[model samples]
Target: MALDEAMLELAAGGSTLLRFYGWEPWCLSLGRHQTAPNRLLGSSPDDLRPGVDAVRRPTGGRSVFHGPEITYALACPARAWGGPRAVLQAVHRALAEGLRAVGVPLDTVQSADAEAGFAAARISAASCFRDPAPGELTARGRKLVGSAQCRRRGGVLQHGSILLEDKQHLGDLAGRDIEPRGSAPAGVSGRGPAIGLNELLDPVPDPRLIVERLTDHVARAFGSPAAAATSASAGIATSAALTRLATGYERVHRSGAWLWRRERPLPAA
Candidate 1:
């Protein structure tokens, strides 16, 4: 979350970045404007599932339980990617191309009205995985990818999660107090019925290989002559400037005050 925000500085300089990562010990991430359940927030490890915690993501979307999943973030100018919806389709199409390379029959949902679908999702769903807004990948008619975007300082950062396992993670929604999101209209979203890679393939492909294919496809999608991978922490942790900026964002990510609302701004790098 911290580094993704820090990369906005590089993005402002006209650099495009595609990052694939995962959560260690797993986590429940809330969208920029989303709310976390009171019981779940600040709960001890014993009070919740093992090896689980929570944080507010720099991007916008509903809460997602990230485990046995691959998370990707793309940061660049909105114009470079066309727009949020254009970026969404391009990234998802790149992901589909990678899945096809690995022999997974991928399906995509294209909403008759994407903007309308997402607008409805903002109020109707509590989980990004709950609905396939439009242009999301799917398997067996169930959602496979979920994403959202947030623009800061003329740079757009889009974050997405690709589920790799079928485990149901009712993380923040385990409490009985929260009401169900309920069903959407026949054509409406909010009932994605997500599936994982394992369910679509006899044996799931290696995570590194998935990352590589995704990188290549995305680079091609964005018209890169040659795509090269970088260490996740190459500049994020080593560069003093980025380190300081990331630290500030980290403070905001962990700050309880900013969890329910997006009052804190992303400190400039």
Candidate 2:
């Protein structure tokens, strides 16, 4: 979360960043203004599993289980991307192309169809993959990627989780199967289902490889210069700035004041 904030800061300063990373011990991340699911707040053993931590993301969206997935964050000036919707469409299209290049055929959901499916699912907002929104990537009629965005400071930060494996534990966490048990929800159009690359690949590819391919495609979509693609050490000022931003965000994100703010409902929204 801190790193993503730093990326936003970079964008605010006219630098675009594309980052891919994962979590340790896994975590359930809630949206900035989302209400925490009751099951997660309960004390039952099944409700509060050991080793699983809960954190609120800076971006707004439903909660997402960050395990067995490759997460990506793209930060750039809103003007450079022509605004939020354009950024989303471009990234999803590039992602579809990249995954296809790697032999996993992918498709994207449309706005109206996704909204209808989301309404019909009637599932808790705690499970992001259960009902994907439009412009998210899907495969074989099931969602393969889930994403969200926040625009501010003349910049935009868009991030998402690309499933590498089926997270069965999500079922236990949400008190229901990760994917709905039966047929598609009524009024849902197109391939509105969810899936993972594990099922599509002959042998599951390494997470590192997936990141490399997707990064290349994302960079291309942004028209990022080749020289900008190389990994370089941050300058002293850059490191210091990132440390400051991360420290501030970490305090609120890890604090009861922020995590349980819904319990008291903050006026800030």
Candidate 3:
């Protein structure tokens, strides 16, 4: 979270950034404006499932379970991308191309009003993957990538999870069953359910390959030139600045006030 925020700061200073990462010890990250999951707030951390931690994201959307997935964050001036939605579409388009290059056929979808409504109604459930949003990526009609964005300080920060494997544990943690069902719930639109690379291919490609392809495609999409440091000494000054910025953001992300700021009374079950 802090690193993403730091990227936003970098964008504010006129530097575009693209990053790919994975979570360690697994985590359930809530959208910036989302209500904390009741199940999470009520249970003692020690009593919660092993390897799962909770944090609030800097972007908006729904909660995402981070495990067995590749996560990416892009930061740039909002005007550079024309706007947040445009940025999302452009990135998704590039991702679709990149994934196809790596042998995973993909498509993009924008959630309709009805689908958005369905997702809104279940926001309290804190399940991001189960409710595909507009401008997200899908494979075989199922959601394959989930993303969200926040625009401020003349810059935008967009981040998302690309599932590499099913996140059934997220369902267990939320106390909800998100297993794909044949029939849609009453009043709900039927979209291909959330899916992962494992479901689309015999052997999932290495996560690094996917990241490299995505980085190349995204750089091309933005028409940005890529540069590399010539030597360790050449990167020392820039690296130190990033380290300082990340340290400050990390402090905020680790604070109790920010993590539990949206706590609310659980609705009657």
Alpha-carbon TM-score of each model against the true structure: 0.81, 0.77, 0.78
**Tens digit per residue, CA lDDT, model 1, 71-115:** 887777767778766776777788789878888787655755554
Tell me the lDDT of model 1 at 53. 66
Candidates arranged by lDDT, highest first:
1, 3, 2
Candidate 1 vs candidate 3: the TM-score winner is 1
RMSD of 3: 8.0
The runs of at least 3 residues in candidate 2 whose Cα sits more than 4 Å from the true structure, single-residue gaps closed, are: 42-50, 108-126, 168-193, 225-238, 262-269
The 0-to-1 C-alpha lDDT of every candidate, in the order given, reads 0.67, 0.66, 0.66
For candidate 3, lDDT tens digit of each residue in 173-250?
355433222222354432236788888877888887787788789988877622212222233226555556767877
Residues 145-227 of candidate 2: C-alpha lDDT, one tens digit per residue: 88887777787888888888756345333544332221223443322245778788988777767767887899889987212
Those runs of model 1 whose alpha carbons end farther than 4 Å from true positions after fitting are 42-52, 111-115, 172-192, 225-231, 234-241, 260-262, 266-269
**Residue pairs in collision within model 3:** 110-134, 111-134
Taking all chains together, the TM-score of candidate 1 against the true structure is: 0.81
In model 3, where do residues sit more than 4 Å from their true spots? 41-51, 108-122, 168-174, 177-192, 225-238, 262-269
Worst-scoring 10-residue span by lDDT in model 2: 225-234
Compared with the true structure, the alpha-carbon lDDT of candidate 1 equals 0.67
